[model samples]
Structure formats: C-alpha cells, structure tokens
Target: MQPTFQNIQEAAQRIAPLIHRTPVLSSESVNHISGAQLFFKCENFQKAGAFKMRGAANAVLSLSDEEAARGVATHSSGNHGQALAKAAQSRGIKAYIVMPETAPSVKKKAVAGYGAEIIMCKPTLQAREDTLAEVVKRTGAEFIHPYNDERVICGQGTAAMELIEDTTALDIVMAPVGGGGLLSGTAITTHAMLPQAQVIAGEPQGADDAYRSLQAGKILPSESPNTIADGLLTSLGTKTFPIIQELVSEIITVSDEEIMAALRLIWERMKIIIEPSCAVPLAAVLQQKEKFAGKKIGIILTGGNVDLEALLSKF
Candidate 1:
C-alpha cells in the first residue's frame, strides 16, 4: 500500500528516538539573496548526515523479528547505504550495501564505518541491481529499496512534517527531486497538513528527468545523468512518481553553474557545509526570484556528505 498521512504520523513516532528532529534555520543573508523568507529544514544535521536515516530506520524497525533477523540489503550511491547500515547496526542485524564504484570515497568509507559489508559494482543501475540480487540471494537478506517503498516514503515525509510544525504559514515548500522519495514525501505532508502551501521541486539541468517526466506526464528514466549533485542521479520510482505528479505544484530545472553558486552562497552566508544536491532548491529559488519574492518558503537541506578533494577537482 502507498503511504498515507497516518503512516507519516506513525513514522514520526517510530523514528523519533532513532533520529534527530533536525533544526529549522534561517539566514538573513540568504533571505536577501533569494528574495524570500526561507526556513531551511536542516536535515544535513540528521543522523547518517542525511534525511535517508529516517526512512532507513523506519524500514528496518517495521520488519518482523524473523524478517529482521535475516538482515537487510539495498543498492545506494551513498546516504541510503550509510543509513541502512546504521539502522541495521542499531538493530543488531547485518546489512549488505551494494554501491557504485564511482560513489565518493567519503561516503563509501562512512558506510563501511557503520559495519555494513560493502559490495562494489560498476556505476550503472543494472550492475548495482545485479550485484545486490546476488548478495540478497546468497544471504537471504530482505531487500529494502532505497526510495520505492511505502514505509520509506512515510518516513521521509516526517522531515516536512517537522518543518511545517516548526514554521507557520509557509507559502511554498521545496526539495530536490531524484528518485522522488523526499519530494514525494514532502508533497504528501504539505498537501495534507499545509494544504494551502505549494510544493515545488528542483532538478539539475544535467539530470532533469523528473522535470521531463512531469512534462511528459509519465516516468522517464534518467539516462547518464551527469551532475555535481551525485545524490540526485536516480530515476523516479513507481510509488514516488504518482505522489509527485498528483501533489507537487511545479518543478524547476537549474544549471550546474547555478547550483554551484547557490552552494557557495549557502556555505559562505549560512556558514554550513551542504552537499550540491542540497543546494538545488535554493538555486531554483534564486533563479526564479519573481515567483518566490517575499514569500515564506521552506526548503529541505538534504545532506552534508561531501568529498572535499573530489568536489574541488570538479572546479
């Protein structure tokens, strides 16, 4: 079954102790820069250094004792791997993480540090799936999909839930769209709780399949996405696509240059380190200044897992 508002509520309660209720922060400088009153739902401060922890914890905890005893497995670029590993460690179960060989070393090391066994595969969707299938088949581990599961969607929605609860009368809520998990959850929460608020999504121009999919009125798979925001490289999931098409108000695409500018601005002005994927929404806001001007907006700053050397080399 698809996740519901009640599921999100339950997820909040279920993962409460397991995750931090990350802060909602605002920067006066950023507000002036974007021409909006921005409330950043700082999930970058979350456990596992990303909002993926909420979904990973909920998915692991929702399993039956017998199912959990078999352990869990998934293919991730980074954050979800770390999150699943952390959750499994906390539950005293093994986790098998299948990761792309191209994924940042920082993230790979972090996943390893969490005690999950890492299986590296060629950096393609097919290779990751094939590798994960072998691991799960061999170990009898339950597959917990990164973003396509109902429990995960519900858990991801809690970030937006907390954002709305902490702020009042938001005109719009925004998040980056990749596999559409966070955006789907954000749209669901905003639609149910702050019905008046519009939920917008930002996509990198280099990987604008979500934007194209919405325009095409169907799920268009992401092919060879090349963006500095490595976290937003996946295609939209079946479950996440329906929610996004129905509840999300709009999607805006921005260039890598715009994303880098927004990233630098946030780093310089807010004095916080955020991954490039986390900068997409803020980039959209800055790019479309007229639409967001003077509006109260909430943006989810998704993660902080950046490889300094790799990122610097990109420039």
Candidate 2:
C-alpha cells in the first residue's frame, strides 16, 4: 500500500506509546555559524538510539498474532537491526537480524544486546538479501524491510509530523537520503501538514545514487559507495522513489569533507554526537548558507550509533 498522510497519522497513534517523541533543538552557535535557524530533530536519544525504532515498532505491531508468533526478520548494518530487536523483544517474539560481516562491531553488539539473533553475511546488498531470504524460509519469519515497507514509511513520516507539530512554520525540512525512506516520508508529511514548506534531501557525494536517481527519473542502484556516512550508502528503493519524486523539491549533494566538517561543527556547537549520515543535511545547508539565510530549516539528526572512540582518536 502506498503511504499517505492518513497512514502517517495512524502510524503516529500506533507508535506514540512505543517510541520517544524526540526533541527538536537549536543552537545559537550553530545558527551563527550557518546563518540559518536550524531546528534539529534529535533522534539519537530515541529508543535503540535511532529513529528506526518508530518504524520497527509500527511494523511489528501491524502484524497478526500468527505472524507475530512466526517472528520478524530484517537486514541492517546498524540501527535498524537493533530497532527490530527491541520491537520483537517488547512483544516477547524473536527477531532475526542479518548484518554484513564488515559492519561495525559496536552496532553488531548493540543488536545482540537487544536480544536478536544475528546472521552475518557478505557486505554486498545482494548477499544480505539472499541470506535474509534463506533465514525467512527457515524460520517462517515475516520480513520487515528496514525502510521500503509501507508501514515503515508511515512510521517514518511521524518524525516529520512531530517536528512540524513542535514548530509550526518551517521553511524547509531536510534529511539524509539513502534508501529514500526517511526523506520520502518527511516529504509526504511536511507537504500534508505544512504545504508551503519545501522538502529537500541531503546526499553524500560518495554515495550519490539518490541525486542521480532524481535526475535520471529512475532508480539507480549504487554498486559501491565509499564514504564515512555508512548509513547513507544504500540505493533508493522502488517504493520510496515514487513518493520522493512526488513530494520532494530538491536534493543537495555534499562531499565527504563537507560532511566531516558539519559533523565536527555540530558536535562542538550543539554538544551532540551524531553520525556522519545525520550530518549530511546540516552540511548541505551550511554549504548553501546564502540561500537559507535566516530561514527556519528543520533537519533530521538521523542517528548517533558511531564508533566514538575510534572517531575521537582521528582528531
């Protein structure tokens, strides 16, 4: 089913009790540095340490008793795996999470700590898909795709809804686009609640499939993306592309250097630790400060599951 504003409302109701209503924050230092009034939706403080919990909770709850008993499965390199695990555990059901063997050890441990069975696969998307298929077959588990499912999209939309609810007159709403799930949902929700607000997507130049797909008018898979923003490496899915095409106004691309700069700025100014992917949107705005000067720009702080010790060691 195609996701809509109504579906997003339903998802909000379903997940209200299940997930945190993450705060929308701003920093005077960041505002001065960027020349834009930025309201950050801090999903790092969310359950499972990411916004994925909202989608995972809604998807798991939407299943039937029989389906719930059969359990749930998904493939994720990080936050989403932990999210699905938390959701399944909440219901006393099993969650099978497929992760690329190259995935960060911190994320792997997080998923396991949530009580999900971890299945390791090769780093490729094909490898994850193939392995997930086998696991689903073996366990009869209902597959809850990380971002492509309608229920998941609906749940994701609620984040934008909350942002809009908290601050009613946003000039622009932005988020990092990977599979296009969060951005597409944000587009739909922003258009629904505040039609005047423009929805933009931030994309890493190293993983620029979303920008290419938007330009080509078709989905273009990224075979190999080399970037620090690991969460934004996935290709846009069929389900998410159409919604993004319909609702999103534009996509802005940023280099890895720009992303890192934005990451450091936010960490220092806002006193928050967000991942590289989460910094993409802020980076896009900072690079285009002239365009966004004094505008109320709302950006999604997508996740915060970083290898902090290693990251801090670099600088």
Candidate 3:
C-alpha cells in the first residue's frame, strides 16, 4: 500500500474537518534574498502545533472498530505523540505514547493534556521502541508507527496537496527529511500531481544519512546523531526510503549553524516560531541561493514546537 496522490486526495477528504487547512504564506524577504518566489506551507499553525496531526488522525481513523477498541500505541520524539493522543481521544480510544526523556517538556505536557498515557524512556530510539513494545504487549494496543506506515504517509502527503492547490506551478518543493516520512509523502504526491516539479529533501549535516543514502542508492543508518534539529534525527524507514528513492529529486545537507540562522530568520522576519528541523529547507535555499534563483519554490515549515527560552539562550 504505497502512498500515492490518489491516497493523499482521499486522506484530504478524510481529515479535512479534523485538521486545519494551514495557510500558505508568501515571504517577501525570502523572495528578495533568494531571487525566487517562495511560498511557505505554514504547518506550524496546524493543530497539535505540527503537520503530524494529519497523519496521526488519518492513521487512527483507518483502524477498525475492533482495533480502536484495543487502543493504539506509538513512540515519538514529541509532535507525533501529541497528535496521536489528540486523534485517539477524539474517538474515545486510549493512546499510549512512549517518548524519550530528552523530549521537550512542552510536548510531554501537550500529550498529557490530551489525556494520553505517557511512558518516558532513555533518550535513544532503541529505548523508545523497547518501551513502546512493552506497552503494546501489556495493553494489547495496536501499534501505530509514526512514519513507516502507508496510512501515515498518505496523511502526510495531504500537506503537499494543499500547498499545490493553493499555489500551482512550483519549480521545486523542499521539505526537511528525518525519518523520511514527510519527504517521502511529499515526493509521492508532487511526483504524481506535478510531475514536472522537482521534489528535494533538506537534511542536517549532523544527521546526513538521508543525503548519503540517496546519493549511494541505499539506506544509510544514522550513527549517533548530534544535531540541533531534534526532529530531524531519525534514519529513513524501510517504507519511506523506497518511495523517496523513486520520487525525490535530491537530498541536500545543511549545517547546524545554517539551520539556526534560518530559525532566526523565520522568527525575526516572518514572526513565526518554527523548530530547527523545519528550518532546514529554508537553510538549503540560503545555502544554494544560485541554484534557486528566479524559480518558484515551495517550502514546508513542518512544525513549531521549539523551546523559546532554550532557543534564546543559544543566541
């Protein structure tokens, strides 16, 4: 069940009233600097404060009555956990969210505010997985993977669908790549609907697995990521990697400093608070300004879950 434009269309219909049709913003400053027309999909303004809500809601809805009765479980760094919790609660279903202890307090509080059970683990992917597995086994909860599942990808694809619908004829579309879910989904939708448009991925240099994997034509695992973009830490998943390889045009890498600079630009110029992971695409534009000159580019501002105080202290 590979996610396609058709699946995304259906997902749009399914999650329309449940999720916000996040605004598409034009940035004059970004346009002037890059010499390109820039349209930003403001998913930071989305419900649950990120685009994860669309996928999470769609995945939860796709479950059968029996499965929903059994409840759902997933592990996330932050945004997806809150999304899943809210979505599950909408259907009167229990959600068990296993999150790393290193996850931001805001996200943990958001999940708890949604009345979902939160299980904290050590700050490692393996630890989160292990804890989530135990919770699933004990509670008989159906596992809802954050990014590796088709339904989730289909839901994610809807973001590009909305963007394309709002502003047609983009030369290139760029989004930050982490687990490759959003990038893969964006690729699938854009490749199908706007075949001429190039779909590129923006990745952190600190976690350059996606960039290396795309170049080598294979999935490369991340070796202990240490990036400021916390959301861009995961290695590409099996399902997302194949789709990305097929549909994505390229993967570009940016430094942590570049990411931070982009974050500052967004906050200072656009008056938006986007996470470092979401800033990677904008960083790519700034890094490769010559390549994008005079082109129409679409950037996905994927999330806005940054810790303001922590971010300010970094300055």
Candidate 4:
C-alpha cells in the first residue's frame, strides 16, 4: 500500500508519545559556507539516536494485538535495527534483528541493549535477507521491512512533517537516500504540506545506485557499496523507490572526501556529533553551492550512531 499524507499525520499522532519531537537547528557558519539558509532537523538526538525510531514506533504501534504478540523482525545494518528493538521493547514484544557482521559494533551493541535478539550474518545483503527469512519462518515474527513497508514509510514521513511544521518557507527538503525510506517519507510529507518545496536526496558516490536507478527509471540493486556512510549502503526498496521517483526532484552524489569534510564541519563548527551518513546531505549542499545559493533548505540529520573509538583513532 502506498503511504499518503493522511497516513503520515496518523503516524505522527500514533507515535507522538513514543518518540521525541526533535529540535530544528541552524548553524551560521554552515549557512555562510553553503550560501544558503540551512535548517537541520536534528534526528540524531532522537530516541535510538536516529529518525528510524519514528517509523519503528509507528509500525510496532500499528500492529494488531495478535500481530504484536507474534513479534516483529527485520534485517538492518544499524539504525533501523536499533529502532525496531527500541520500539518492540516499548510495546513489550519480542524483536529479532538480523544484522550484517560488517555493521558497526556500537550499533550492534545498541540493538542488543534494547533487548532485541541480534542474529549476525555475512556482510552481504543476500546473507542478511536469508538469515531474516529463516528467523521469521522459524519464529512466526511479522517482518517489518526496514524501509519498504507502508507503515514504516508513513512513520518515516512524520519527521519531515514535523520539520515543515516547525520551520517556515523552506525551498527544499533534503535527506540522504539509503533504502529510500526516509527520502520517500520526506517527499510525501513535503509534497503534501509544502507543495512548493522540492524534495531532494543526497547519496554517497560510492553507493550511487539511487542516482543510477533514477536515471535508469528503475530500482537498481546496490553492489559493492564502499563508503564511510554505513547507514546508506543499502539499495532502494520496491515501496520506497516508487514514491521517491514520483516526488523527489533530484538525487545528488558526493564523494567520500567531501562527506568527511562536511562531517568535520558540522562537528567543529556546529558542535554536533553526526555520523558520516548524516553528513551526506550537507556534503551535497556544499558540493553544489550554486544550486542552493540563497535558498531556505531543510536537511534531515539522520543519525549519530558513530563508532567513536574507530573514527577518532583515524584522526
């Protein structure tokens, strides 16, 4: 089922008590550098340390008593797994998260901390899916896809809805496209609430399937995605791809170096700790300053679930 504006609204009300109404912030230095007014919806501060919580809460809450009793399951690299775990804990239900072995230790620890059983698999997407399938078949858990499900998409839309409500006169709403869940939600909400605003997505150059898919007019699988933005390594899902294709105006690709620079800028100047995935949108803005010059842009800072020990050691 396609998620609509009303679904997003209902999701907002449904998950209201379950998640934080994260603050919208701006950095003057960032604005000056980008030559645009950048308003960041800081989902990094959200419960579970990511905006995925909004969708996870909605999906879990929307379940019937019988369905909830069966529990929920999904395959995730990090944020979504932690989100589903947190949401399931809130509802006092079981959650089985199938995670890639390559996912950051911090994210895996967070998922486990939320009381979900983590099943580790090979780093390949195929392995993650196969593991999840086996777990679901054995456990009778309802598979709540990380990005492709209608409930999850509607739940994701709430973040952008709140962003539009708390801010004024946004010319564009931007998010980093991983499986396209957040971007799809952002597009649906922006088109509904602020029809004049364009919805754009930022993707890592190394993981440019979303960009390639848009150009090819189809959903393309992501293979050998090599980037620091671990959260964005997945390809666009079936449900998310259609919504993004219809509503998103563009998909911008930025290199790893640019993403790192943007990440550092946000940390040094804005004093916010963001993971590399969260910096992709800002990297896009900085990479193409002329396109966004003098515009009011709203960027969703997706998550802050960085492996600090591993990251800091490089510096």
Candidate 3, residues 1-315, lDDT tens digits: the string is 677688888888988878999999987987897688989999999999999999999999989999999999999989999999999999899999999988888899999999999999998877988898899999999898989988899999999989998996999999999998888889988898789999988999999999999888998899899899989898899999999999888888999999999888888889988998999998998899999899999999999988777777888
Considering only N, C-alpha and C atoms within 3 Å, which residue pairs clash in candidate 3? none
- Best first by lDDT, ranked: 1, 4, 2, 3
lDDT of each: 0.95, 0.92, 0.91, 0.94
- Lowest lDDT sum, 10 consecutive residues, model 2, at 306-315
| TM-scores vs. true structure, each candidate | 0.99, 0.98, 0.98, 0.99
Model 2 lDDT, residue 306, Cα = 91
- TM-score of predicted structure 2: 0.98
Angstrom error of the Cα, residue 257, model 1: value is 0.3
Alpha-carbon shift of residue 169 in model 1 (angstroms): 1.1
Off by over 4 Å in 2: none
Off by over 4 Å in 3: none
Q: State the displacement of the C-alpha of residue 234, model 2, in Å, after optimal TM-score superposition.
A: 0.5
Worst 10 residues of 3 by lDDT: 305-314
Question: Total clashing residue pairs per candidate?
Answer: 0, 0, 0, 0
Compute the lDDT for candidate 3.
0.91
Candidate 1 weakest ten by summed lDDT: 306-315
Poorly placed runs, candidate 1 (over 4 Å): none
TM-score of 1: 0.99
Error of 4 at 201 (Å): 0.6
After superposition on all C-alphas, the RMSD of every candidate to the true structure, in Å, is 0.7, 0.9, 0.9, 0.8
